[model samples]
Target: MMNWRSAPLAPATASQTASSEHADERIKLSDEQVAAAQIKLAPVETTQLAEHFLATGTIVPDADRIGRVAVRVLGTVTELRKRVGDPVEKDAVVAVLESRELSEVKSEFLAARLTNDLQQTLAARYKMLWESRSYPENEYLKSRLTAQDARIRLDSARQKLLALGLNEAEIEELPNLPIEELRKQSLRSPIKGRIAERRVDLGALVGREGQESELFVIVNLDTVWIDLAISPTDLSKVAENASINVTAGPDGPNGVAKIIFVSPLIDKDTRSAKVTASLDNAESKWRPGMFVTAEIPVPGRGAVLAVPKAAVQTIEGAPTLFVREGQEFVARKVQLGHEDDNQQEIVAGVNAGEVIAVSNTFTLKAELGKSEAEH
Candidate 1:
């Protein structure tokens, strides 16, 4: 990288460095004036320009976070607490029910618990009697067998209560509650989320049966999916785990998300595959159902000599760059190469370490045009 800041170039060599312009086509502005115009300068160097593929898609609810909530026991809603769009915590009760069927289940559990206690007591007593020779061996064996039968029945009853949405803690508390409170069951959300839907109304009968069985739909919108549609032509460019930037619209929500899913199969009609990314939306600003434009970076071909995109100015239909020469700025046209959103490669006419006008290149271009017209 040679410094382009050496002695002032003669007319012949200066023209050779530019795009076939006269040897002296130049624009000279003072550093103070350049600062006033907000013109900025940067050194040209070889840079890797990562290409990108643009696609449009929509934000959707994370499928993993959406929950379909229901109760296992048949019940009638007696007290409805939550409504659609209401936020809920994990295990938060959404509705209370008065279930006659549940009363029978609780009664069965209670009876089995009592029987298990009695049988265990009997088993202990029989073992004691046999060990002390107060009871015959056959008699103790009979009592032990009866106790085992009662124990098995007790375990079956506890399992049945569990299947009916009773957790171990609830089952333990069941024996402490009065019979009247035993039938009172509540439907709770298993996850922390907003209630997306409420399928049951107050006094509505709910059971473990048909489609109406599901009572609530809870969704965690903190993290969501942005589905980017990739055309088959660009399918080879998109891959899983690639970083993508998504914007809903100008002045709307925008976020950086990583591509976590790329569909293997393409839609027959649209001929496009769905590429998905996950973005954190803890603020709930990026709502579901929002259409978003995604910029997915395509892998680079290789490293090349590049310049800032802002440094290149269109002069008389030619891609011209202002090369810094001593105290003056010389307008030089350069061959262009691969370009991306931020940087464009300089295929020819410019070398690494050469200083160029990065900001306000238009003002320099106008001055160069005026200089040429004078000839």
Candidate 2:
């Protein structure tokens, strides 16, 4: 065993000479106490502590990939194929609505088309007869005007069906559709995503004038938005497309993500700017609404004196480290600098190559506090 009884004390000023000696007194631990205290020690040394800024945020749905499914026609929902959490395909059918109003529109379209066809034939015949001098010019002109009006009415009726979600193929086939099929409108999803919400039920009355009834909300989870709040002091430290490591609880990141968006508007209440990061959630590890921590590495000023975070102890509101000399653990005041996840840089009152307590520092503080009370 090494001897510390003969070791000389550190030099101090007139005001601190007495207090410093008291603070630097040794912590005498029996072999059993040392084992029970779980003391760990490491040399006070410089370490390359890459700087990082921590910000909190939550995973949210990417706006570009989210879609709200709604119906335009006045109808009653007859069938719902997908429920919440179901995976869907692009242009997939989400639900079916039965509407008498739609059926009436189809009937008007069929009637208008027949009228247009009849008028067209009459106008052609009148033109031929007028060229042959077998019909009057005024009769031909009147027939031509009738044909044009019928054609306009036919186009208007077709457009009304189109606005109700019928494609060109379905519009073309509508004239021949059976009465039952003509009234059934299938609500289709516009994009590929998972069903996030279901707002309609079977036999539910839906669709109103000047408004659309939302049936399902689909969201693509392949990519998710990380909604982060950056404080005013840290706003400049983070920027668009900066590399980030997101973590769950205290663990390391599940995967790397990049800052995609940063809001210019600062929140009045929190005094923080909104920032966003896009992460690949193909494996679905980072799910929406899950709170996470984002660690962004910023440029460091330069190297400085540093040590493991565990080496520092809070004794009477001051940061202190227990230095080891010849088996003696002495409390030493320390000044700290830039810190990150792994290390804390020591600015003053500690020198390189000195052994300091790295773990179980609370035990040393408690022991020192008891001795100080006794004195």
Candidate 3:
């Protein structure tokens, strides 16, 4: 440290002084770099990486399998134990009908049976006499014809009872029980389902077989139908066995449905075709008339790079994107694929995990336009 300041002054040439001044200028520029040349970066969120499609539809019951149980005979409802949404077993009594016509049919069937039995006994006697030559052949033949006519009458009467909704078992059991007691016929559920509608109240009169009166409508809710209306252009995308996602409420149970049928005809007014999807509704959460939104996934064109819809921009009718390169963003033209509601498919010009300007993409675009003009 001996005379260090005096030794530095001894070599104070012009070149040395200019070198010091250059160093001071460089330090000053470094201090002002942030304010003079800083780039305004736009913060953005990353896009989701997955495959999905969106569709809107409504929920409905399978009408083909659903049935309405009605009274075969016109009568007052003597008993109605079931209500809407009540699960009913097949052949379970849902209501009771007091019908005088049912009693008359049962009485006719009994009389026909008595006549058939008497004719059978007389025919047997005639057959024995003819075999022993005690009766003429024509007389025996006539007696046999009479027996056939009686049997025909019996069959006719049995058919009438069947047409009246009486099963064979009930017809056979009729003679064993009092006919008057069977006047109040219990209407059983024709199918295993939940009661969807009830039109007849207690003591209300219902129509008979010839009349048109819907007493109760039961629907098998174990399997439901999702009616999705697809636009004519998208109709070809929907195929048999296409996978669908069914949602009930905003945040309710979700179920998978399969495209069962696509209507061959397009709706004249809506210009859309009905695409039917079958879903399992054993939980009973999906009602017949409830509206639902369905997401039907059409076949994708293989996996490709994609980004958020917001990250993309349009330049001269071409889709453009801002790709981050080092500390700067570069404008690039990209080929796009099918676009959904939120995201679009990037077919080319970008790779996975590459940062893209999503928010304030227009600002990046403006910078790109300026750079292009300057060049």
List candidate 3 stretches off by more than 4 Å.
Answer: 1-53, 208-212, 300-333, 339-346, 350-375
lDDT (Cα, tens digit) per residue for candidate 2, span 146-171: 99999999999999988888777777
The C-alpha local distance difference test score for the whole of candidate 1 amounts to: 0.83
TM-score rank order: 1, 3, 2
Residue 252 error, candidate 1, Å: 0.8
Lowest summed lDDT over 10 consecutive residues: which window, candidate 3? 22-31
Best of the candidates, TM-score = 1
Q: Please give the distance, in angstroms, between residue 353's alpha carbon in candidate 2 and its true position after superposition.
A: 19
Taking the tens digit of each residue's C-alpha lDDT, what string does model 1 give over 6-34?
A: 32122324544365456456655556556
* Candidate 2: residue 105 Cα off by (Å): 1.7
- On lDDT, who's better, 1 or 2? 1
Candidate 3 C-alpha lDDT tens digits along 240-333: 9878778877777788899999999999998889989999877777876777887777666655556778788897689987665543355667
lDDT of each: 0.83, 0.82, 0.73
